[model samples]
Target chain A: MSPGSGPHTAERRGRPRDSGTDSAIIETVLRLMEEGATIGALSIERIARETGVGKATVYRRWSGKDALLVDVMKSLEETAPPLKGESVRNDLVSCLEFARRRGLAKRSSAVLRNVLGQIHSNPGLWGQYQETVIATRREAMHEVLRRGVHTGEIRPGVDLDLLSDLFTGPLLARAVLRPDGSLEEGLQEGLSEQIVDTVLAGVAPPPVAGG
Target chain B: MSPGSGPHTAERRGRPRDSGTDSAIIETVLRLMEEGATIGALSIERIARETGVGKATVYRRWSGKDALLVDVMKSLEETAPPLKGESVRNDLVSCLEFARRRGLAKRSSAVLRNVLGQIHSNPGLWGQYQETVIATRREAMHEVLRRGVHTGEIRPGVDLDLLSDLFTGPLLARAVLRPDGSLEEGLQEGLSEQIVDTVLAGVAPPPVAGG
Candidate 1:
C-alpha cells in the first residue's frame, strides 16, 4: 500500500473535515436560536450563510431541517455514561445525578435553554425530541425501577411508570416549572442522593412481622 | 338624588363599563399571542389595532403590556377552589387533581398552551406569571405536604419542598415534556388519585412491629 494512500491518513483527513463542519453548523443554529430566531422561520440558506458554508454543503450532510435538528439535539445531550451494575440505590443515584447535571447545564446555558424553550412551539420538533432524547432516558430510569422490584428493593403492585415519575418529577419540577430557583447552588448538590433515599424509604415493603 | 343616579344603577353602569372593556382587551391579547405574536414585540398600538379599540381604551384598563398580560393570564386560569381540608390525603389529591384539569385545559386550548410556551422566552413575563399565579399554588401544595408531615402521613426529616415537586412533577412532565401523550383519555382519568396514592405509599411511616 502507498504511504499517502494508507487508511490512517484517509481516516484522519475525513473525520475532522466533517466534524468541524458539523459542530460549526450546529453551533450557528443554536446561537441563532439563542438570539431569538424561531426555528419555524429559519431556513437553510440563512444557516449556511451564518456558518460560511454553501447550502449544498449542508444538504450533503443532512437531508432536511428536521433531520438536522435531531442531530443538533444529540449534540446538546452527551451520550449518557453506562450505569454501574451495582445495587439499586447506587444505580438510581447515578440515574438522577445525570438529570441533576443536565438540569445544571440547562440553567447555565442560554443557547440550550432557549432552544429547549422553543421545542414546544413546533409540534413536529417536539415529537422528534421526545422520540430521540426523552424516551430513551425515560426507559432507562424505568428499567432501574423494574430491577429494584425484582430484587425486592421496591414494592410490587405499584405502577413502575408512575413510580419512576415520582423519582424524576422533583428534579424536573425544579428544572422547568421553577426555572428561576434551579440556580440555587445549595439545593442542586446531593439532590440525586436525597431523591433516591427519600423515595426508597417511602416505598419499602412493610417490615416482615417477627420473621 | 335622581332615580337614575341611585347606587344600584350607578354600580351596574360602572361594572360592565370597565369589565366589558377589560375582558375584551384581555381576550384580544390572548388571541394575539395565540396567533404567534411574541410578547416582546407586541406594543400597545398593535394590541389596540387588533382589538379594534382606541389606544386610550387599553391604557384605561392596564398600565402597560406586562400589567395587561398579568390580567390575561388570570383569565386563563380560573380561581382555584378551596381545599376540603378533610385529610392530608384528600388535600394532596385535590392539589394534583387541579393540576390534571390544568393539563387538560392546556391540551384543549391552543391559546393558553401557546401563550404558556411563549412565557419561557420573555423573562419579565415569566417572573410576573410566577409571582402572581404559580407562587400561590406552589405554596398551597407545600402547605399540604407540611401538614402531612405534621400529621404523620408524611415522613419527617424529608424536605417537604422537594417532596411536593414529586407530586407536581409527573403531571407537569406529561403536560410539557411529553406533550403528545398527555391527551390520552385513560391517563388523565384518576391520575390525581394514582399519583397521590403512589407517592404516599412510598413516604408512609414503617408499621409498628409485633406491638
Candidate 2:
C-alpha cells in the first residue's frame, strides 16, 4: 500500500523502528565521546545532527540525553562479554579480565570514568546511570560472591560487596590512574590471576591466616 | 657595620633565601591547579607573573617548570606525613588512612593524578617526576614491605611492589573512580581497617588456605 496514495495508507503511518538508525545514532554519540566530548557536552540534537538523522528520530527512541547515555553505557558494557559460570575464582578473574581488557582497549579508561563522574553534576542523570547500569553490574558481581559463599568458596564472615571492590580495585587503579604505566609490559599480562591469587591467600603468613 | 656601608656587604650581595617567596610561588602553582590548570598549561613565566615575582627569581629556585612541579608534589606529599612504623598491618592501615584523608581533602585527587597523567605526553618531564617523586615513594613502600618480611609480619615469596598496590587499591579506587560515592558515609570511614583486615584475612574458606 503506497502510504500517501490512499486514506487507509495515510492513517497507517506506522513503520517498524529502524534498528540501523538506532545503531547509527548510538555510534555517533560514542564516537563523539571517544573524541573527548563528555556526557555533559553531548545533546540529542547534536547527536542526531552528527548521525545525519532527524532529532525526532532520536527522541522517538530515548526520552532524552541521559536515556541516550545509559544506552551508550550499555553498548560499552556489551564489549565486556558475559562471565562463564566456572568456579568463583575463575569468575572473579573474568570480571577483572574484562576490566583489564577495557582499560587496554580505551586510550584512557578515565574517559569513561570521567564521563560517569561528570554526570554527577546532574542528579537525575547520575541516579539513572547508577541505578540502571552500575547497580546492575554490582549485583552481578555480588551474585557471584553470594554464590561463592553458598558453595563455601568464599569465607563466611567477609563482606561480599566489599570483597568485589577488593578484587577489582588494583586492576582498575592501574587502568584508570595510569600510575603504573612505566612498569614492564610483561608484568601486567597475568594481572587478573596475580591479584585474585594474592588476595585469596592473605598477604600475612599462614599462622596469621583467618586474622 | 651596616650592610650597605661595609665592603663585606658589597661582596656578599646576598640575603638568606627567602622562604616566604618560595612558599608564595608554590602556593600560586597549587592555586592555579585548583583553578583547573594542567601541568602543560603552566610555565615559569606565567607562574612568576601570577606570583608577582620576576622570572629570574623563579629560575634561581627551580631550573624549569617541571622542577617547580616536582616541588609542588613534594609539598602535597608532606601532607601525608610519616608512617608510624608500628607493624606491617598498622603501617598498611596508615597508608590507606592517608589515602582516604587525601581523597576527602581535595575536591578531586584526579587533579593531582591528572597532572601526573597529563605530563606523560612529555617524556622528559614524566621521567623526571617518575624518577624523583614517584620512585622515592615507591621505595618507601617497598622498604616498609621489606621490614615486614624481616619481622615475619608479612609473608615471604610475595612481590613487595605488587603487594603494595593490592593493599592500597580499594580505597584508591573509591577515591579516584568515585564509584562508591553513593554508599553510606560510615561504610568508607572504616575503609582503612576494612581493606587491611579483609585482605590480611584471606577471603577464601580455610580449605583453600594457601592457594
How much of the true A–B contact set does each candidate keep? 0.53, 0.37
Query: CA shift at A150, candidate 1, in angstroms?
Result: 1.4
Task: List TM-score per model, in order.
Answer: 0.78, 0.66
Give the clashing residue pairs of candidate 1, or none.
A202-B202, A202-B203, A203-B202
lDDT of 1 at A82: 88
Query: Candidate 1 recovers what fraction of true contacts?
Result: 0.53
- Model 2 spans > 4 angstroms off: A1-18, A35-68, A79-86, A107-111, A179-184, A203-211, B1-77, B110-137, B177-184, B187-189, B201-211
Per-residue alpha-carbon lDDT of candidate 1 for residues A1-84, written as tens digits (9 for 90 to 100): 345322233354446456777889898887776564544457999998888777766887898776777677777877778888
Number of the top candidate by DockQ?
A: 1
| TM-score leader | 1
Residue A159 of candidate 2: its Cα lDDT?
71
